[model samples]
Target: MADQAEKLRDMVDKKKKADKTHKVIAVTSGKGGVGKTNIVVNMAMLLSGIGKKVVVFDADLGLANVDILLGIKTKYSLIDVIKSGKKMSEIMIKVNDNLSIIPAGNGVEDIANINEPSFNKVKDELRSVVKDIDILLVDTGAGISRKVTFFLKSSEDIIVVATPEPTSIADAYAMIKIMFLNYKKENIKIFVNMAKNENEAVSVYENINKICKNFLKKEFKSAGFALYDKKLPLCVREQKAISEIAPDGKFSVSMKKMINNIFKENVKIYDNPVKRFFSSIFGG
Candidate 1:
C-alpha cells in the first residue's frame, strides 16, 4: 500500500511538472523535395543558437529524413513511444545542449494506426513531454496525409513550406485550402522556401493569396520566405545544416530574419492580431 501510494504520488508530481511549459510548431508542405526537413533541422538549430531550448520531433512517418540530414541516427523513435510503449522522454535524443530530437524509427506505420483512445493518450503524453522545452517543433511529412492534418490542427503554428514550381504552387494552395476547410484559417502560417528574390516570393504568396482570399473567404495567418542560395544543397550533401555551413551566407541571413520575425509575430499576435492578420492578408 505504501509503495503503490508513493508511486502514484510521484507520477502525479512528474505529470504536473511536465505540463508547465512548451510551444508546439508544426512544419508542413504540399510537396516534397523543397528543403522541408532541411529548413526544420536548421531552424531548430538557429533557435537553439539564440539561447532557446528547442526540440525537433521527426513526426514524418515512413519517409523520415531529418535523421539522415543530421547524420545522427537514433536507437529509438516515436515508434517506440507508440509501440515499444515507452514514455515520451524515453525515446528522446539530445542533439545539442539546448536542442533535443525525437525521431521516427521503424514501425512508424504504428504512428498512423493510432485510434481515438491511443491518439488521446499520445496527445496527452506528448503535451507533457514538451512542457520542459521552450519550443516543440514537429516535422510533418510532405503532401496531404491524414497524419499531416492531425498535427497541423494540433500545432500552435503550422509552417507551410514550398518552392516555385507550378506543381508546388498548386499543391501549396491546395494545402492551405485543406487547412481552411478542416479548421480555422487564422492559425495556419506559410513559408515560401527556395525562391529567387523578394519579388518571386511575393509572387508565389500572391498567387496563393488570391485564391484563398477569393474562393475560401479566408486569409493567410502569417508569411515568411527563404530565397534560393546555392550553399543550401551543398551543405545538405555534407550533412550539415545551413547555418552550420555558412553563418554569413545570404540564405542564413534571410532565414534568421524570418525566424526573428516569427518570434516577434508570436508576441504580436495577442497584442496585435488584427494588424498582423491584415498584413498577412495583403502580403505586407
Candidate 2:
C-alpha cells in the first residue's frame, strides 16, 4: 500500500510539472514559387478559425512575405528582437483573437548568426510569448540551403509542399532525400499543391513515396493536396485568404481536408516545440 501510494504521488507530481502541449508544423517547399507561403497563410488562418491559437512564423527571412500575403504591414521582425531589444510579443502582429504573425524580416540572413547572449534573449522571449499557443506554423523559404533546412530540422512536424510539375516533383524528392539522409527526419509530410485532380495528386504522392522507399528506404506521410483553383490567384491578388473569401471553393475544401489529416494524425507532444525550435537555432 505504501509503495503504491508513493508511485501515485510521483505520477501526480510529474503531471503537474508537464507543460501545455503545442505543435510546431513547418510548411516548406523544394523550390521557389511553389505557392508555399500561400499554403502556410491559409493553413494558419483556417486553424485559427477553428479556435486553434496559431502563430505564423515567416522563417524565410530573405524574402519574408507572410505579412504581404495577409495584407498587413509590419514594422518589426525577429531581427528587432535581437538588434533592437524588442520583445517577441511587441513585434508580433495579431491577425485575430486566435491568430498572429511574426515576420522574420526581409533580407536578414540566418538568425543563428547572432551572438550567444542575443540568441538566449530571443529564445526566452519566444518561449514566454508562445507558451500558451496551440500551434506554431512556420513558413520556411524554398530550397535546400542551410537557411531553409534549419527550420526543417528543428520542427517536429514538417509539411513539404509540391506541385504536379516534373521539375517540382524532382526538386521535392531531392529536398526529402536531404532531410531523410542528412537529418534523419522520418516524420516529414507531403502536400501536393496545384494538382489538376484528386487522382493526379494521389499519383504524385505515390510516385514520391515509391522513390523514397526504393532509394532512401523511407516514405513520406500525405497531408493531402490542393487542386488548381482560378479563384486562389484572384484571392492572392486581393491579399485575402481563400478560405476567408471563398470558403466553399476547391482550394478551401482541399485545405480543410489537409488540415484535418494533420490534426487527426497522432503526433507525439514534446514539452514545448517552440522552445526547442529557438534553442536548436543556436545549438542551445
Candidate 3:
C-alpha cells in the first residue's frame, strides 16, 4: 500500500515537471433538475465526435449520476482512486472511441466535502489520468456549494445551464453572483436549456444578463440554447446521450452548435493535464 502511494506521488511529481496544455471546462447549473447532466453527457459526445479527446469528470460527488445516465457500469470510482490507492486509469470507464468518464463515487460524503489534504491526495492520483486529454469536462453539482464553486474556479471556462423558468433563472443568477463575488469569475457562458423557442431562450439569457449587468456588473457569453424536445426524456429513460441516440435530433444539433460557440473564444491550454487538474482542485 505504501509503495503504491509512493508511486502515485512520484508520478504526480513527474507530471508537475512536464508541460501539457488542454482545455478545462466545467458544466454547472444554478439549481438541480435542469438537465445539466444530460447536457454534459451529450456535450462530451459531441465534442468527442468532432475528434477531440474528451474526458468527463463526474464531480457531482455524492449525487453522481453520469454513469447511470450513460448506462455504463463501473467497478471503480474516484473513491477507489483515493481510498484504495487505485490508479485513475483503473477507475476511468471508456464510453466510446474518444470519450471516457471518471466517476466520483456515489453517496460518498468524503469525496463531496473533501478537505485540502484529501483533495491534494486525490489530485496526485488523477494527474496521469488527465494527461494528454484535449478537453476535460467537469460535470459539477448544481447550486452554489463549495464543491461546485471549487470546480468552477479551477476550469478555464464555465458553462452555466439554465432553463426558461422563473426559479431556474433566479437560482442561476444567484450562482453567477456568488462566483463573481468570490472568485472574480466574469467570463461565464450561458446555455438556455428546454426553451420553448429561440425567443424564449434569448429572453432567458437576457434576463440573467440584465440582472448581472445591473447588479453584479458582469456580462455572460451566450453559448446558445437547447429547445424542449419530447425525445429528450426518452433518451434519458434509455440512459443514453441524445447525440448518440438521435444524432439528427434537435437537441443534438443544438448541443453541437453550443459546443462550437463555446470554443469560438480562444482558450488557454495548460501544459500538464495532471498539474492543471490538481491546481484547479486546490485553488493553486
Candidate 4:
C-alpha cells in the first residue's frame, strides 16, 4: 500500500509539471473597430491579475496600437529583432513583474521591410518568448493583410471578436470562410463583442452558427462574447483594463468566467497563434 501511494504521488507531481506548458491566444477580428485590441489587453490583464505570466505582442506591424491604448511607449519593435539580429527577449518590455509586451518597431520602411525570411525570424522569436510565459496574447492588425492572416492562422485559439452589425458579422464570416478554405481547420471559437446583452450575443452567434452548419458544413466552437457596455469605453478612456477598472462590470465579470471556462476545458488560449503562415495564405 505504501508503494502504491508513492506511485500515485509521483503521477500527480508529473501532471502538475506538465501543466506549465505555455499558450499564445490571438485576439482576431474580421473588421476593424470591433475592439479586438481592448479584448486582448483585458484578457492579458486577467491572466496577470491571477498570477499568470503573460506577454502581449502588438503585431499590428505598421499600425500598432497596444502601446497607445496601454499608454506604454516602446523604444523598439520587432524590426530590431530582424535587422539588428537582437533576440526577441531583448525587445520585450516588462509592463509589470508578471506581464511583458513586445511593441512593433518602426524605421523599417515599405512593404519590402516585411518579407518571408524576416517574418519567419519574427515568428521563431515569438515562439521563444512564449515558451517561458503562461499566456501570449497577440494584437494583430485589422483586415486580411498577408501578415495579419499569417498570425491569425498561426494562433491555436482564434478568438474572433465581432459586433452585432451586419458588416461585423459579414466580415467575421468572411474571415472564418477564409480559414476554412485555406487552413482547412474548420473549428473556430468566436468571441462576439458589443452586443446588447447575453441573449443578443447568443443570437448573433446562432446566426453565424446556422450559416456555417447549413452552408459551410462547419462547426464554430464559441469561446464566448461581451455585451455592449459603457464600462468598456470608460475603461479604455482611463487607460485601464476592463477587468481592473470595473471588475464588477457586466462584461468584465462575464469575460472572467469565460477565461476560467477556457482553462477548465483544457482548451488552450495561447498556443498556435498562426504558427503556419504560408500554407494558410497562398497554399490553399
TM-score of each: 0.82, 0.83, 0.83, 0.85
Candidate 2 lDDT tens digits, 18-103: 63468888888887788888899988888898888999888886688899888898899989887888889999999999999989
lDDT for each residue of candidate 3 in 153-228, tens digit (9 for 90 to 100)? 8787888989988999999999888888989887788889999878899999999999989998778889889989
Off by over 4 Å in 2: 1-19, 107-124, 265-284
lDDT per residue for candidate 4 within 185-267, as digits (tens), equals 55468888888877898999988878778778887988888877887777777777777666656667667757876766322
Candidate 1 per-residue C-alpha lDDT over 1-284 given as tens digits, one digit per residue, 9 for 90 to 100: 99999999999999977754677888888988887788789888888887788988887875677877888878877766666678878878888899988787644556665666665666776887776788988998888887777777888888888788989888888888888796764577778888888899888887877778898887785458888999888887888887777765656766676787887622122124565476478753
lDDT of 2: 0.82
Count of clashing residue pairs in every prediction: 0, 0, 6, 17
Global lDDT of each candidate: 0.77, 0.82, 0.83, 0.77
Return the TM-score for candidate 1, rounded to 2 decimals. 0.82
Q: Roughly what TM-score does model 4 have, to 2 decimal places? A: 0.85
Give the best candidate by TM-score.
4
